[model samples]
Target: MPRRHTPGHLPNDRLTELRSSVRERLGAPRPQSVHEHTPDSTHEQTTYSAQKQTHDSVRGPRTAVVIGRLLGLTFVLCFATGIWSHYLQDPLPWMRFPTRPAVLYQVTQGVHVAAGLASVPLLLAKLWTVYPRLFTWPPITSAIHALERGLTGVLVASSLLELTIGVMNIYHWYAWPFSFRTVHYALAWVIVGSLLAHIAFQLPTIRQHWRSRPSPRRGDAAVDVSEVDTGPAPIDRVQTDHVPADSVPADHVRTAGSDRRAFLASVAAASVAVVGFTAGQSTRFLSAFNLFGPRRYGDGPQGLPVNRTAAAADVLTTAADPAWTLEVRGNGIVHGFSRSELEAMDQSTEDIPIACVEGWSTSARWTGVRVRDVLTRSGIDPHSRLRVTSLQTRGGYAVSEMGPEFAADELTLIALGLNGEPLDLDHGYPARIIAPGRPGVLQTKWISTIEVIG
Candidate 1:
């Protein structure tokens, strides 16, 4: 019934049919291979299903948002207080600091240093949670993305330098070549600007994860939203369709959640620990608990921690000179007072905390002539601004500016005694400025002259 076929050859009609079938198959439009992708970047055709899985437990947008919020809060606090401190230190011609609180600078500076230290942990955690973005796929997907990444780089670099130098400054370490104040202040602006820009770029993602969204079947090998940057996450996901190599399988979903929780707990604990140890330096009662603080609040000459010893300032010889006298100079008026004369004038004692820029502080009983009384004796306006000079010949703080409120404050004193004892040779023996509501640096030590200024 069927035509007989040769072993190695087919009939002419059969061969023609076979050739035609092959030609049709070759000419038909071919389906794209799973490994192929176009330049438009609609989908990422990955050969390996696994993507990067580092820190998967804590590597998500949610963690980033939480840590970012905390880091942002501290940065805000640090920025606010830091600005206050800078203004106080370098007041503009029209600026005048308040005098009522008396310990305003103390509190503000303490907050500044405390926030700075607290940021250490928050910053580290934030970096850890978001570092994966550094290796995001299609690393330079577009020019806008490239610029966004550049912004992120600036934000991170400036933030690290800021926190690093801030911590160094608190310890009174000047290992850098640049002026800490100048660089620190400038970096603050950079950080704030970059931070704001970053937030604007990330608004969609931040809002998306501002509150938790429903999880997608737990561990369904989902793409990490945090890696999506500040872009519209839904759209980014559609385009990228990335699944991190480290994503847990559905069976391990609970384990992933547990790991994330553990990571968060660890970060919180670290922050608490850092605050516990360093914040105590500003709290007098917590002095015993402070370990890493550069100065102990209770341990120094005359029971006050002294950052710069009279010896270190090279004022030891000049301070002890018997002729050392505090001179009050004003418009056509000059009055000088020996240590005995200062103690002889009406003495005022104020138990106030003297806080250093470094953040350590101590409550001391300073008894000496009221600054207003001296200004009045010198026939000068008690509220006149002053140029206070220290006996130390060499030092940036050898001379300091004084606001009128300090001269007018009844509690402001040129102290010759501390804690019921005469000033120690190391404690500005002849006399030292002790003003309220100001930084200790302005409490110019080893006083030599006070001149009234416009």
Candidate 2:
């Protein structure tokens, strides 16, 4: 025989009987007390234990919420960090750091790439946990929702395509003709704008949900109560009530089966993507360490083979400070760094690729003081745009202004080495510059003077 209940609350005797029945079924000790409480201040705490099972079923487990929260937090952090890594520079003055071989650049770049790859898994997990709500037609009533969706679509498409091409490029798989950086940069704005809007709309929802849930302690599972549909009781209680299928609705059975199949399909797809992405790639995505050392491809003029150019005048500066001065002689922008004084700042090295807008990338190992450190030593604010004068070039390279954060980008380096040896003359031997994810034109070679302008 099955137990049944009406809409009305159980009588006092029936409540007591229920408790006894539960204790016997579980072979557990009876509660210290068992009785229905009047709806009063005194009764709230008293009735808590008696209604534990019923309340638990209605509210769901604490573990479910914790898992959701962890997934959400991880995805959010990865997304923010990934975007910031691409856009923002590390704030540390690179010129002040010790100059090492370009191997350091390779390791850091690999980490950056790997973290990006891992985002696929993290993003999918987050979406899965929240996908049920997508069926609610329009999620938000305001125009903000439409704008957010638009931006998000653009960002998603851009980021995925950019990453895909980048991975292929690293492995020498060249099938795309478009300039990766140009396309990637243009799409980045869409993603960033959409991300900001998404965060804005979710702020209120996040706060409301946080307050309603109990503070999750360390090691305690986060419970997700937001998805609990208590609007109406489920008809087929196969899982909920352990009821036989004969008494359940056909729709209930169908829905449960569909959800199961969908979950399985999603898992299978994720496995395939991870495997397919790594196949035949020079650098394996699954490995924590990269076999390829730090070195950029095509640091010089693209399409042209490796060669040397003779400038009208040699502008190479040396450590010999007997008569060295950085002549900041352009547009009233005063900035100077003696060879000795420039050497006094911290040095850094990065093995970054010199990517050119002309459709090519080259690898090289750079060793020099950090440009940021040099600017700081010269008392120049990093926020100002810089005009770098090269000895081999007649004109200056007009680099845009970057906030202090850009100087901190570990990839930015004032290089002094090539291929494990001192810089060759043909290359920017005396001193050069290297910055990650930036076009080669910005990396002025044979650096003679750096002028700071507003």
> How accurate locally, in lDDT, is each candidate?
0.72, 0.44
Candidate 2 Cα misplacement greater than 4 A, ranges: 1-79, 82-111, 120-162, 165-386, 390-420, 425-427, 434-443
Instruction: Provide the lDDT at 12 for model 1.
Output: 18
The true-structure Cα RMSD of candidate 2 reads 14.3
Residue-wise C-alpha lDDT for candidate 1, range 1-454, written one tens digit per residue: 0111211222211222233234334673321232233342222222111111212446666678878888899899999998988887899988888876877877888888888888998899899877656765556667887888888999999999999999988877789999998999999999999999899987765875676534443232133333442242224232223333234233344555577678878887887777777767778766777877777776777788886788788987889889888888998778889888887778888876788877778778998888889999989989889999998876667888888877888888888889999887667778888888788888888999999997
Report how far off residue 209 is in candidate 2 (Å). 15
Candidate 1: pairs in clash: 51-245, 53-246, 102-437, 202-230
What is candidate 2's TM-score against the reference? Answer: 0.40
Cα lDDT of candidate 2 equals 0.44
- TM-score per model over all chains: 0.81, 0.40
Residue 368's C-alpha lDDT in candidate 2? 71
Evaluate model 1: give its lDDT. 0.72
